[model samples]
Target: MLRISAEDDRDVAQFQQLHEDAKKNGFGRIFRSTFLFEDMVKSILLCNSTWEKTLAKMVESGKLNLEEMERRDMTAEQVSEKLKKLTGFGAFVTATVLMCIGYYHLLPSDIETLRIFRETLETTAQSFYDRFFPFQSLAYCELSQLDYKSVSGCSHIKQLKAA
Candidate 1:
């Protein structure tokens, strides 16, 4: 049997706190793999593309033979090339898909994530990564929700507007 252990370190403690806080706020853990293909397509569509364009591309790509792509068992580079031929996906989008496929560590940094970091944390992406380290994506998800709630008045809209 495979065994795992964690030491009682500051990093571990911080991660536990973050996870608990997210759960307390009714934010369930995000398992991106459940909808891997769709997520990959959406991530690709989002690169240097408007929301409307992305939606349109999603509809268009939906008609393609995605299962065939899966059957080929291509390398990440080959998969990227094939996706580009099929959907005109850019390097960022290709990298995003590779990241999804467990080949990369970093999340695809995009304009929206950058905006969230700037508006919510008032800090650089590098600083955010340094603070969160391995849990950057999880931290981003939690903080992004908080940021949206703060700006959009998820509760007490009138009070927020008044202030």
Candidate 2:
């Protein structure tokens, strides 16, 4: 889910430029943060639900008023509490907020502080996984010996090679 809190002022135009660059570089899906309440609610919906169910529920809800979230006086803790009151949310969202507690300490008291915290947790998770248990060529070597690329569904690796 998109956990946004206010922060100190910074270069918005630069952030937009970075966003555009990320989009061009195929990171758009990971960096999608617009001012739309629907998008934000959709982000919440997607927290634990399957993609189809989340989209369907958001479309069904039509509009979710989360603008109070951007209020200068609101705290992330308060916002998280209010969000839990909403109908569709569940424990997963609550857990996510708990996970975000460390970041909340530095949260801006104002919701319009002008800077977006683009945490790279997803990238960090992948890096951690790779560091601990990286992709091993031995697995691939055995698979290749068996000529089981088709059965094992290595289409992506094949595409990578062709490219």
Candidate 3:
């Protein structure tokens, strides 16, 4: 994933090509939108319901207002209970809220920090996966063997030949 970060010269070239490839594959949005907030209330509600049904209900009912809850002196437990009243919300959603509150304080307030932390976790995990898994390199070699010569340009291939 560091290769996707455009740090190394080879990575810059590869990332550019990858950008083009992603555009060709109709997936440019996947790379473009990096930081996305999970709408906790919507996610909770959609737990068992179809996404379309959940969205329709949400549009009809309006968004959950955390500020209103706070103004009403409602605690996290109260808010979680309110969410569970919605169809599809269950023990999992309530448990998630309890866990998140315990670990990180609360929703909205911890969102930015959580986003950063999650990004860090993903990057770290990807690095570990890359180090442990030779699947990518092996796949590239197989592609080269199949006459897709661009597989020779794989970063692992270049690194291996340099060694």
Candidate 4:
């Protein structure tokens, strides 16, 4: 997730100025050194009980090729479609993979994330997406990281929960 791309770093740095909450929170890029395949395996393990055996078999048989995906520089949509065809991959897992691969435009919301946004933030997923646009996931992540009490005076996303 944390590739050392100066270009990406610059873009994310500029993104901080776009949202008031993001600017207030000093949001910045978080790098992860783990490979995308490893991230996928970790995400898969969370949802699928037979994840170990299934993932091993899939990779060994060349069904899920990380190299090819990287080489193609496939869009998040393309990657998502391929992952959705596999077992144990719903929107959450697929979105996790896409995010790990640097696709911050997509929001990866599980049921809890949905509940918190609805109950705590008083905002729907649509509203979050609408506010943040291409950087929705990044903004969502930063907002989620804030202290609930600290953000009480902010617009919308009230009663935020610490996550």
TM for every model, in the order presented, reads: 0.35, 0.31, 0.29, 0.64
Tens-digit lDDT track of model 4 for 11-81? 57777767777778866565554666777778777765475444567777887788666544787788889
Scanning candidate 1 in windows of ten residues, the lowest lDDT window is 1-10
Alpha carbon lDDT at 74, candidate 1: 59
- What tens-digit string does per-residue lDDT give for candidate 1 at 41-84? 57755664655434345445675444444444656667666656
Candidate 1 lDDT: 0.52
CA lDDT of every candidate: 0.52, 0.42, 0.46, 0.67
Error of 4 at 107 (Å): 1.0
Candidate 2, residues 1-163, lDDT tens digits: the string is 3333333112333344667865466331222245434444554565545554333454357553344444434566675676566654455544333333322233222222222211233333334335335564554455569855553322244332332
Q: List candidate 2 stretches off by more than 4 Å.
A: 1-32, 47-65, 94-163
Clashing pairs in 2: none
Off by over 4 Å in 3: 1-37, 41-48, 59-63, 67-73, 98-163
Stretches > 4 Å off in candidate 4: 20-26, 31-33, 121-163
User: How good is model 2 by TM-score?
Assistant: 0.31
Model 4: lDDT equals 0.67
Please report, as a residue range, the 10-residue window in candidate 4 with the lowest summed lDDT.
154-163
